[model samples]
Target chain A: MIGIAAPLGYAAYLSFFQDRMIGGNVFVGFDNYRRALGDELFRAGLWRVLLFLLVQVPVMLGLALVAALAVDSGRLRKPGLFRIGIFVPYAVPAVVASLMWGYLYGDRFGLVGQIGDLLHVDMPDFLGSSWMLASIGNVVTWEYVGYNMLILYAALRTVPHELYEAAEMDGAGEFRKAWSIKLPAVRSALVLATVFSIIGTFQLFNEPNVMQSLAPGVISTSYTPNMYAYNLAFNGQQFNYSAAVAVVLGGVTAIVAYAVQIRSMRKEQGK
Target chain B: MSVNTPARRRPRRASNALTIAMGLMLLYALLPLIWLFMSSTKDSASLTSGFGLWFGHGFHLFDNIGDVLSYDDGIYLRWFGNTLLYAVVGAGGAAFLSTAAGYGLAKYRFRGRTALSAVVLGAIAIPGTALAVPTYLLFSKVGIVDTPWAVLLPSLVSPFGVYLMRVYAAEAVPDSMLEAARIDGSGEVRTFFTISLRLLAPGFVTVLLFALVATWNNYFLPLIVLSNPKWFPLTVGLNQWNSLATGAAGSGATTTNFYPLVITGSLLAIVPLVVAFLFLQRFWQSGLAAGSVKE
Candidate 1:
């Protein structure tokens, strides 16, 4: 009960001060929601995060799948070494990863710069406005690809060998067997990874937040919805408005994630 | 089943290609970490100009370590200590709570077990970052903001850990054994602590590792709740230094030396996680292998 008490009690107390926090003389029920909906930056932040969702999620998951497939095929002689090496980045704290990448993305003293000089072609400034999102996306993809690979690989191992044997008997090659048997078997795990990726997408904070300091010209205070909410509450001191934004962002995530779950569940049930 | 000789010969060629491709992919994954290790040894000037894959001037490594240790009155050491405290206490508490909840859900036919399990499943889908704002609001209202308790308390509720324990407990602990414990005049708590918990050792270790890593790498939540530098974990502290490094880089100050410190600090921060992974790798492998057999 104490587990429940701490959070619930805190939320209740915060709820009581919504009027004072917002600076509205009139008591407004869900007016903060109205304000949040009307906020341009909030909408832009949402769109930016959605854009990230569209691009990065698929790439990250695809990389993970390919890595998992490669590692799981028993073709890799040193599977344990490869697995540990791949998963090592996931264990690196996000802040450190961002810093390391931030340096790499630096124009003057970065590795890319040195390489660019050697090649006699200017490397794109990763922290610049045009490429910042892609730069952060690269870091995120690098960090998580292996983590998701481990999950999918673990799921892939659960697939029975008899299915592959049967496929082999049918004169199916490795690609055909993977497509016809392995992929379908790990479909649920893939869906789980997708849903996790989506939820994680919305909460993209650390990479961009840390990067903002590294490259302030590129990252805005409202780079992502979470960053927007953090700035609104902490910097702007508009706690009520921040809470409203947070609630809405949480709602969007929940609704989308729930829809994905239900749709996947229904698909599984139909199968 | 005997393979046909002609077709079997073709499969070997394809598998060889696949093996080479997999090896390359593993190399690609490890390249950045290798880069980090190499770069950490170099001076700032060499870090930019020298071969990125090779070491340059090992003098700066000791210098960087000393600088990192001495920075802002040795706050890095404080952050390290606080992180250890957080990981130990938070991971320990999370494991205990998760075990108790998981055991209850797995063994006892409670009224709301299904509902509780469903809630936990739903909670697993909700990212920890989503809950950060709500948790911050909740913590602030109770006047625990900027305190270690704010960070520690929230770290205790890992829904995934609970879910994992529940699933593992269901299979690993036999009901017959619990019945036997009951027959031997042991209390439920005694049975749980002695018999069931012992049986759940592998599961416990798995949960502990998960909780420890999650809490150790937890940057966003601490960033939100704690403004006090004293309470900042290594992630937050390092980020602050990175921000300061960015400012100094802009001004072209003598503090350019701090870049080495950040690199070395990052390298040091990675050690504990590597140690944890190494320590737990055997257990994780065996646990997953065991899981594979049952499935």
Candidate 2:
């Protein structure tokens, strides 16, 4: 409990105060929160992550669902190999994944550049200002898609085979069986993964931070809210403001994750 | 046998299509690792000049590994050792605590069980990085900043691991077993350590590996907490090398690019994990179901 609560509680406590050179960490009483709410960098980072969540989560989870359904349908050969092959990336640390993708995303010396030159085709700079969001999305999607697939796949395996036979007797084809039977079975798993992804999206730090070097100007210190708060405390020495940003980010993440949880619970009950 | 009728025959053909599609997903997943492996074989120059997807000029993988190990007074080896220490100790402690707490939560009657479980579940949703700055502040106040404890303390608690253990313990450890142990004069703590823990072994290893992956991959906590290079884990140390290379490219710094070393180091970092996954994935499948299998 100390591990879970102390820092967060301290963070909440620290958020209300600002350090002044004259007075030395005086209680500012909502000033920092006001500033954090109005801060352009934090707001932009917030919106950017929202955009990333919208574009990336569905694509990644949708693909995971498809992969899980395909394997669970008992149609795939070497399902074990297929399953583990996909999950191998999840085992790769986010920092390593970012560095790997950062190297691959490099325009001058990266794989795409070399491939483009070999094919006589111009490759757009993947880690450029406009593309960095999607580039980071690609890295995150690669890492978690298989992990989520495993979760859904686990749920699928637990589903009674009797359910499938019943669906078959009802004349359901593969698609219909998946829709009517397999999908409902994994509904809770899907929500769990979605909530995890929601939390992950809000905590987007490693990818953009590690990739910042490769795309210096393209990826800023405030590329994500977590990164923004990081830069504030570590780089700018604004611990109070940073604490406020973090608390707000944590609050926002909890709200969304809680909402997803509640909605999934309601759906389960409604069924 | 009844299901293996003519109706299943059509889906067999459709299964062929599913096999091909899953094959693509496997390729998509494996491509980057393939790229990482192939890239590690090349020296810095060939990395850019040679084919990106295939073997680059001379196979300098061993040579690059040597360079990565020997560079800057063999700091990569230090970082590797540090990573191993952090992962082993941090993940090991987290697994034990999570299992103990989860077992207690599962078996023993306690006040506010619902509230405690809800809090644990709620804690899982909080983004870890969001706690970094505040954690730094808290640790600094206690003068633990820049120490291993700063990294280890935060990593030692995983709410998800606890949740996994709770669910697994509920299913894996029968209440009757506990009662039998108690009747046999085993105290609660002794009973847990002796009987319940043995039954929860698979779940224990599962959470252990999960915590292992988590601490191994952890970046933000250590980034804020540890300023000294000696304490830096592999992730932070590798990024430092990467930045040295990227920093040089970005500006006219005298930072000579450590491109080969960084790539080789990255390849080296993930090797243990990939091996672990390959070996444990079948066993790990049982653990994944523990969550969904819960009431």
Candidate 3:
């Protein structure tokens, strides 16, 4: 508790003050917050990640939901092969996964480049500015889709056999059974995956950071809020302001996550 | 029951279309891994020339592994050993602490249980990277920068792990069992260690693996705390090698064509984790579902 609390408390304290060149770490209350709130790059970075979440979360979770349904449907042959296949990527570190995909995304000697030349076709640059966001999203989705599937599938497995038998005896087909039973049983898992995705999207650092080397100038120093704070502290040496960004981001994440929890809880209760 | 026909006895199953869709999902997941394995086999020249899915002219997988392991005074092996130490100590310690704390919260009603639970829940939602800079500030102020404790200390606290153990403890460990142990003149600590810990194995291993992966994949935390490459985990080290491979010259860069090394090194890094996931799938399957207990 001390380990987690002390730093957060320190960050809250630090967020209120600003370090100045001439003033020698003078306490300037609310100045840091004012600057961070109005900072365009920070806002842009947050918006970009929000956009990422909007697109990536559904695609990833939808695929996970489908995979969970298929595996739990009891007709898939060699389910282990599919289960392990989808789940294998979850084990790859984000750093390593990003690196592998970065290489694959490369246009020079990467697989895309090799294929493009072999067929003499023009290929859109994946690391280009327009596509970089989605490219990172793809890497993240690939890494986590299976892990989320397992979570949902685990939940699906817990749906009582009695419920299925009741549905089956009513002459419900497979799709009808899934529609009425499996989806409802795993509602909590879906919500959990959503909350996790929200957190992960806001904390987007590793994928973009790793690919920054590959894309060079395409990935600015402030591509995400976390990256922005990182740059503020390390490159710009604005630790006080960086602490402000951290606090603000943390506050936003907590509120949003809490909102998600409340909404899901209400929905579940209403059901 | 005797009137039921054989046609009606067969269970309804998923359609062929769903199975095909699942197969495609499997394909999408496996393509990059397949590419990675194929990339590792080729030497630097053949890596660029051949197709990514198939093996190249020379099977340089062993040679590449040897070089990756031996390059720069065998620093890859050093990083591997460092990752092992951090994963074992950090993850092992985290699992123990979380188990003890969670069990305490579940079995015994302490004065600050509500407050601690609130803090734990808040911590779970807090973005860890958000604390990175402040943590560096605190660590630097306390003069613990560039030390393993900087990473290990933070990794010791796992809110999710605690939550999982609390759920598993409540579900798996019966209060009557503890009552019997107490009647046998067992101390609370002794009874917990002897009785509740075994019942908590699945959750413990799940927490251990989570911590292990977090520490192993840690980049931003270590990147800020430690400036020395000597203490770099494979994630940071391979990244350093990656930037060195980016055709950026004059920063003491390695050869620009060291993609083979990077590819092979990445392959090496994920092998242990993949194996761990494969072996522990059953535990993690249940462990993940255990999270829904609170929900």
Return the candidate ranking by TM-score, descending.
2, 3, 1
What's model 1's lDDT at A74?
66
Which model, 1 or 3, shows the larger TM-score?
3
For candidate 2, write residues B132-220 as lDDT tens digits: 88788888989999989888888889899899999998889988888898889999889888788899988888899989999999888
- Candidate 2 — which residues are off by over 4 angstroms? A117-120, B1-14, B248-251, B254-257
Give lDDT tens digits, candidate 1, residues A27-108.
4567778888999999999999899999999999998898888888866667778788788888889998898888888864
Runs in model 3 lying further than 4 Å from the true structure: A115-121, B1-15, B248-254
- For model 1, the stretches where C-alpha displacement exceeds 4 angstroms are A1-26, B1-16, B248-254, B286-295
**Fnat for each predicted structure, in order:** 0.43, 0.77, 0.68
Q: Write the per-residue lDDT of candidate 3 for residues B93-174, one digit (tens) a residue.
A: 9999999988988899879898887787778899987789989999999998898888788888889888778878888899
Clashing pairs in 2: none
lDDT of each: 0.80, 0.86, 0.86
Residue B271 error, candidate 1, Å = 1.0
Which 10 consecutive positions of candidate 3 chain A have the poorest summed lDDT?
A: A160-169
lDDT of 2 by residue, A225-260 (tens): 999999999989998889899999999999988988
